[model samples]
Target: MKRLVLVALVALALGGCATTAPYGNFVQPPVTVDQQQLAGDAAKQLAALWPPAKTRFELQQPTPDEFGAALVGNLRSSGYAVLEYAPQKASGAGNATPEQKDADPVVVVTPTTVALPLRYVLDHDAGTGLYRLTLLVGSQSITRPYLEQNRVLIPAGYWVRKE
Candidate 1:
């Protein structure tokens, strides 16, 4: 009975560690600037790591604001096909008319090629008056720091890319 109980306890502990989610969801903070220039710079750096035309990006986070918009635009301009995911609102608490359902039919695209999932983190340090933008693509990540002055952001240092 003692050995059986120990095995049960071990199984329970291992069960708690299992998770289905591929990655943790992080809240993206707002930025003061539109970040067009910064996004362009980041896009250029990312293009060096991954060829823009060859690689397709599926952005894992919603970009409802300026910085996200800028990043998406920049990535597109850099020849990347970026797909941003946004959750669809339930129609009237799941009671939708047939007409409504017909109007918005769910279209799923199964590409022959795999698109890399991309995530980004934009954080501001109040004490240092600096902004850090980190882009994570597949298993790699690149981070760059920026300093804001008079509504313009200047690069504080070189990008640090990590595999």
Candidate 2:
């Protein structure tokens, strides 16, 4: 009886350790291009622009916190203002309370590819990691000519790079 109980306990413990959402650990499946195309397109659009002379960016994906932190660092280096991130928090049963009602304008980031590619090693072990991500730098003030000239907010395929 004692041995049987111990075995059952061990089995239960091991089963509990298994998980499905394997992030930050094992190498995930290969990320397809379709998953990350939008962000790539947005980045290409921003890269083509030469104005806003003093523009700012706000990232909204790959875990909003991580994106925001990186954007803040990048913008700071580029001499652009780094605005505060206002994460939407659950308010009640039906809606989310505004973390900051006067949140700054932001550009959203979306992970086109959620899985990582596999690599072959001497041991032939598989690994998981994140591949490229597609970001959309959208803003409500989509009027300025500089923004227009760069075709920043233009629909996809307007200036898609063929690489």
Candidate 3:
């Protein structure tokens, strides 16, 4: 009986871990198949405007976050190497000269949200007393980001994709 109970406990523990989503920063950005596919197209379009070199990008966060990741992933999937650029911090070596590392130019990718309606449904099985998520759609636009003049406008879905 003791051994059987231990085995059941171990199984339960493992199952709990298995249910967790995989994401390091913030919640897994709520992204759909269509969202990724459309974002991929946007990345390709942006790539064409720049010279044929590895394009580094400064993603406007929550531009939305998931959409940004999708954009970067799609850009990579499209055979282009991408890097995130952060402005170099001032080296406080007071007279210590730092090596000048040449870097490829980076473009700031910003997202602009549009209005759209997303309905969410929640269902509770009375017998189980557990609430289940039936829908994740958000009230925001599903339009992909676009470049106007010089700015890259991301869609509202990225913003409202979560909350």
Taking the tens digit of each residue's C-alpha lDDT, what string does model 2 give over 1-163? 9999999999998888574322221213342223122333433344455222355554332323332344344445544443444457775534534754446646678644232121110010223222222233442211111111131322322442221
lDDT of 3 by residue, 67-109 (tens): 4566667666666545443446796546544542333435677
TM-score result, candidate 2: 0.27
By lDDT, the best candidate is 1
* True-structure Cα RMSD, model 3: 16.8
Give the Å error, residue 75, model 2: 2.0
CA shift of 101, model 1, Å: 13
> Model 2, clash count?
8
Which consecutive 10 residues in model 1 have the weakest lDDT in total?
A: 19-28
Question: How do all models score by TM-score?
Answer: 0.68, 0.27, 0.31
Give candidate 1 regions above 4 Å deviation: 1-32, 86-109
- Minimal lDDT window, size 10, model 2: 115-124
Q: After superposition, how far is residue 67 of candidate 1 from its true place, in Å?
A: 1.0
